[model samples]
Target: MDLEAFRSLPEWPMILRDSWETNAGWWQAGFTEGSDVEYEEQIKPIVRVGLGGAHRILDLGGGDGQLARVLAADGASTVVLDSSAAQLQTAHHRGSSVVLATGAALPFRDGSFDGVLICLVLEHVVELDEVLAEVARVLEPGGRFLLMLNHPILQTPGSGFIDDVDLGEQYWRLGPYLREDIQMEEVDAQIFVPFVHRPLSRYLNGASARGLMLVRMEEPPPPPGFVARAEEYLQVQEYPRLLVLHFERRP
Candidate 1:
């Protein structure tokens, strides 16, 4: 769908949630524990360290509680909150403390969590400011907010590996990096997921305005196992596919 089409839909959020609900089974099966190499090797490690010793953790948009289960295994009281009931059901069945809610309006008290994690979720959310505000509100003083995303510049719509035959070299091509728009990504044949493409500054500045101070930022390349899956990725191995920002709630 085009930008105008997406904007015209007043129930976009609900529509998005419905899409996830429909794809919940597929997603669960595909990313089940240790199935995704990037999550197992890179994302999980970084998130764990970013959260530090926080006992009360909130996994925002935590679908099926994959990360939440890992954090809970480490003895943290990890609560998985997601908008899709189908996703939350799987999480609950997997022994996770699940909450059905949206990130824009968290059904929790102020300073409810010591650490908040929103992994690869913001891209799907149009209400970025509201979600960030809710994140800041729910995090206690000095709490960490781990914001993980598919690298905005690298993963932007139309961005991909360009195999230039004339040059006999492969390079990464970036799409309309500065232009923020919503695009649909096909997960399966005829199954499309919507993503909001925003510049890097948008996230950093938005969080900063919400009293979420940036502590550290990591732009890591694709994991070995991920690159090993395809020959094309081997050439652009240095390019980061993930952007992780560790932010602290300003006291």
Candidate 2:
């Protein structure tokens, strides 16, 4: 539990609130942008298989409840918990039951949820240890925890898609993989989104310490048509972009 080195960002909460509040519309619009290819071909297949037997599910940081609505339609009693009020409003508009809450402090009783889905959210969270601990606290014994992250290796600091004409290939340049830092990725001319670059060991060890047993994991490539969109997508196909992990709360 010695997290003295990886301290949480003091300004992250305010930054997150401001970013989402100002760019809620833009976030919602791109929520399901790659639904046809990314979700259907890669992510949803794993989710569909992993969540097969679960009943009660919590979509932690389920912005705009796009994935929450899909989980509900599949017969799971689903609830979306997000920190952004504007995102919650968008989720409500989509008929999803939404709660405005951060993952670090979940207002739920122990063993309340039979399953949890945390997709692409941890990168933005500054309080990584707190959130993972809360995820363990809210899950029932043997409950499934399906997590999706931007692949740590592929999305590390100082990494980018490069179309090398001299090398006659498209590839990704990656380095400084172990350095943990806060990064601001540009979303629009006036907006930038914050993400924390954490190593794989941090995520795995943190959850393992809390008794979440990893049962399944995948580093899936982008679907073929993804390469058609841009030359950057070609590099994504070559390297892993998404890390899908399915863990079970130990009894």
Candidate 3:
């Protein structure tokens, strides 16, 4: 069921949690981590360049400490914060300092971290504004926050890759672009995850209202092998797969 349909039912939260909790082990099998190559090559460089010399960093909602391991490998003092206990267990096993906590209520003190990395996370969070406020509160003055998410435009509800075989035209079809809603997406055949959709304005305006300044934004192009695959992958060449944003806490 979609978010709207599930909202009317009282069991949505339990269902959502069950889906993630049950799939936590399967999720760690790295089938979903195919983008790690892209992250290491494209995403991490942007983060390192943006952070400059930041030492203490928080990987908020960093499942299984994937990016935390990357940052730690790069010589940063990194901590992985996630709401999933099962996921945290995997992160802990990977030698990452894992904290079990929601983003809406970070347990750290003010100015506790010099930088924060949130990747493919906000779309699953219901309390996005509250989380942004908490990010601003915990980050040191002039600290930066790097965000990477599924592109709001390309990933909106009902949007999908379209292949016109006869015309030999392949592209993406956008759905209701402006609506904020919840969508249940199939990750694997049996797993359905909840994704909350919000407009780009919601992120920028929300961060701005919380004393965070938007420093830069990037929609990195697709890797060569991505669009070189099947016809369904061709749409990636016409649009970005992720939206990367850099925000700074004001002094």
Candidate 4:
């Protein structure tokens, strides 16, 4: 379906969830274990460092329990939560404590977890403020919330690498960074995934308003594996593709 057609649907969120349900198998095959280079090399290490020393952790929207497994291996009690039952089933079979739930309404008590991590999931969620509030509510005082995102400015719909033959130079071109909108990303033939784009200020301000203070932020360049996948990417190797934010719950 085209973007205009999708925008006309009243239950876009449900449609998005159904799309994920249908693509769960494909995602499990592609991203499970160490298959995705970006996840294994850059995202995982940053999350490990940001949420270190936290015993009770919640991996919100942690599909297939990849990150949760890593935390569990480090001896932290980790719970993997996702709205897709098919994804949670794979995680459960892989020995992760799985919960079928949405981020906006977590199935837990206030201050239930010492650490919460959401990686590459927020872009799909429509209720950003509600999710952030729930994240703050479930995190205990001084708890850390590790958030990972495809860099907003770089991943915008129209953003991409540009090769200028006339100028004999190659650079990255950014999309409408300030425009906040949801669009359908065609991941495979006949399969589409919805992605919501919001500026950096929205995330920072939303978290801060919900009593979550930013402790640290990291913008990591493309990993070696990512750069090696394409020759043109080498030209923009210094540009970061991932944005990791570490926030703490205020006491």
Cα-based lDDT for every prediction: 0.88, 0.81, 0.81, 0.88
lDDT of 1 at 211: 99
Candidate 4 collision pairs: none
lDDT of 4 at 45: 81
Clashing pairs in 1: none
Model 3: ten consecutive residues of lowest lDDT: 30-39
lDDT of 3 at 101: 87
Question: Candidate 2 or 4, higher lDDT?
Answer: 4
Which of the predicted structures, 3 or 4, would earn the higher TM-score when compared with the native? Answer: 4
Per-residue accuracy of model 1 over 22-85 as CA lDDT, tens digit each: 8888888877677888889898888778886889999999999999878887889999999999
What's the number of clashes in each of the models?
A: 0, 0, 0, 0
Q: Which stretches of candidate 1 lie above 4 Å from their native place?
A: 1-5, 165-169
Whole-model lDDT, model 1 = 0.88
Pairs with steric clashes in candidate 3: none
Compare the candidates by TM-score and give the number of the best one.
Answer: 1
lDDT of 2 by residue, 32-97 (tens): 644446765776667767776689999999887877767777889899999999989888888888
Local error of candidate 2 at residue 10 (angstroms): 4.3
Writing each residue's lDDT as its tens digit, candidate 4 over 99-144 gives 9989999999999999999999998887889999999999999999
Q: 3 or 4: which has the higher lDDT?
A: 4
